[model samples]
Target: MNIINRAASILLLLVFFLAFFQNSVHGRPLLLSMSRPKPDDAALFARWLVSQSSWGVLNTIASDMGGAPFGNVVSFSDGLPDKGHGIPYFYLTTLDPTARNALKDQRSSFTISEYAIGTCGKKDPENPSCAKITLVGKLKVVTEDPKETTFAQTALFTKHPEMEGWPKSHDFQIYKLEIEEIFMINWFGGPKPLTVDQYLQAKMDSHTVIA
Candidate 1:
């Protein structure tokens, strides 16, 4: 009887370990884990994308690729968890082409999809109603000031904890999109006419933007 009990205990432990390994997301917990707002709430929808997403396609004018527009997948953050301020920030290194291109030409746009957030069930990525935002503006490197770096790092590490362990030789630096234009589509009929001010200042809990 003791032998059988020991075997059962070992089996249970193995099951638990297997389950834990399957669920672990790079040894860090996900943040801003929340459901999406209604499609009518444009502000909330935009905020939901910026705050909840861990990465997006950062568009820049490629110098090596015959000056064509280049889009690279990159991780980003605005603020801590749900406290996002609506300005997307990134951690990049010169070793990558996106950072080099941005330095030469600040004109850029960053795009995120609602489908990535899993709110657009059964909808194709090209569907306008599925929701996507392209923030157009200048990509400027953030000042290396200690205070600013700390704030950005805290915001980034909260969501992408694995980033903290990147090799130091790569010289990762903080960059931000100085948004000047907003283009978002969250519902049918047409694209939403949302401005930069309306997007940034839109209260998270308020639904002022009509579909």
Candidate 2:
């Protein structure tokens, strides 16, 4: 190869290594924020975590398990990536205990972790700095409004392409968390004091850039 082409090839390889170091100590996003919000900015931090996560543990008031807070890992979405509305939506069915429990009692909460996105550095998953949130509210099935179903289907299929091909026999239905409270810890001290109003209304227009 010519000397100029050889020089360009080396430069590209160096650039690639730098990018690997920068993104994963590290993280990447598309309907996601590039960085964590200041811990004190409770509202922003809560919103950032929720918008970036595609799934979390959903808790419900169990009936068969004797009313315990039964937690189940499930997939979810708030909106389309960074364009979220700060409300989490889900795809579930009666085949799962979570959905069945929700029908008997709507009281529920959903929890997500920043560590799942690889932005927690080397921190342990349970470490406070890794960032975790529990959104408390009601989990209800969507019995009406076809439009909401359409929006949810698009959101789910986009993030989890595999769901599109899942067996039709499973009969998955749409569900949502009507958030009434918020609990989050992105750093030290303790869970930041944030309320549902502050969380849902926090502006994210500045963080709307997508991949």
Candidate 3:
């Protein structure tokens, strides 16, 4: 019995470690071995964080809940793999409170952490060096412009293939955050003072492996 128990314990530990490292190894599409940017490159770091991550907590003002802030786990994409454009695009439906809330009030914010991308190994999510970003902006639907809608659809579908098969009756539409302010923490001191223009303008190095 003691031998069996020890073997079981060892198996569990092996599974845990594999699960932890697998994200870095296979979670991303093309980025199999991309190293994170230095803490000082605020814009590149922020863009990298957004591009590498596939989902995040999107916060909106819930009108039905007495104007309270509500955060929902949502899937989003900036672009395909290493081609991210820095603006997060989402596929949402009114059946969900998040889309309903956005329709009533466009004010919103989206937050993503480096921990999700698997680079912040062994560090608590809240640890100062773990790196996190919150994009403050107005969430708006993108059906008005045919060009933008096409881009959104391609970007979202490429990253999240399952979305293509999502129930159409739910009326999922493309929505994007028009980032106005950027707040990021990659190192210790405090939130990195990043501007929307800076973030959008920041260019990823061709050599940088991001996917």
Candidate 4:
């Protein structure tokens, strides 16, 4: 009987470990430990994609490039793992063209692809089923208020630890996308018409289950 009990205990431990491994991706815990939200729920789905992503393409008008649109790959975070504000924050230096462009013209947009989160399975990134979002609005530096700047820096540094060690001479500052419009495509239909308010107000409750 003792032998049988010992075997059962070992089996239980194995099961628990398996469950933990399944919930984690790349050996890191997922934000909120939740799966992809249903595509029908545009607001929640958009928020989930933003929260899970660590990087995206930030677009700005390039005056030096003849007033053309320029896109740069950048790292960003919405907030800490559990508390996502759905507002993308970035750390940039004026030495980089992205920051310089933003200063010249605040008109900008940030795009995130669900493929980066690794939930799309074998689907191509451009596939309709694979979700993507573009936040269209102004990209402004967050420096006027000390409190807001501190909060933005914290939100950025927590997700991107390497930022803390960047050279100070580069003068890296905080910038955020003030989302005026949200365009998301997660399914066969056209892009979902999600307003900035709807995207910002979406809640990630217990019912927002994984795919």
lDDT of 2 by residue, 1-211 (tens): 6999999999999999887766655344333443667778889878888878877999998879777889999988877767677888898979999999998899999999888876788999999888999999999987698988888778878777778888889998889999988889888888888888899888887653434
TM-score versus the correct structure, for each prediction: 0.81, 0.85, 0.85, 0.84
What are the runs in model 2 whose C-alpha is more than 4 Å off?
A: 1-4, 14-33, 208-211
> What is candidate 2's local distance difference test score?
0.83
Q: Candidate 3 residues 135-194, lDDT tens each? A: 999999997889888888999998899999999899999999999999899899999888
- Candidate 3 RMSD computed on C-alpha atoms after optimal superposition onto the true structure: 6.0
Query: Compared with the true structure, what per-residue lDDT tens digits does model 1 show for residues 131-193?
Result: 899999999899967887788888888778878999999999989999999888888878787
Model 1 residue 56 CA deviation (Å) reads 0.3
Model 1 spans with C-alpha error above 4 angstroms: 1-32, 144-146, 205-211
Cα lDDT of model 4 by residue, 1-211, tens digit: 9999999999999999888886674754454456777899899889889988888999999999999999999999888764678999999999999999999899999999888777889999999999999999999988788977877788888988889999999998899999898889999979998999989889866444554
**Candidate 4 clashing pairs, residues 3+ apart or interchain:** none
Per-candidate clash tally: 0, 4, 0, 0
Model 3 TM-score is: 0.85
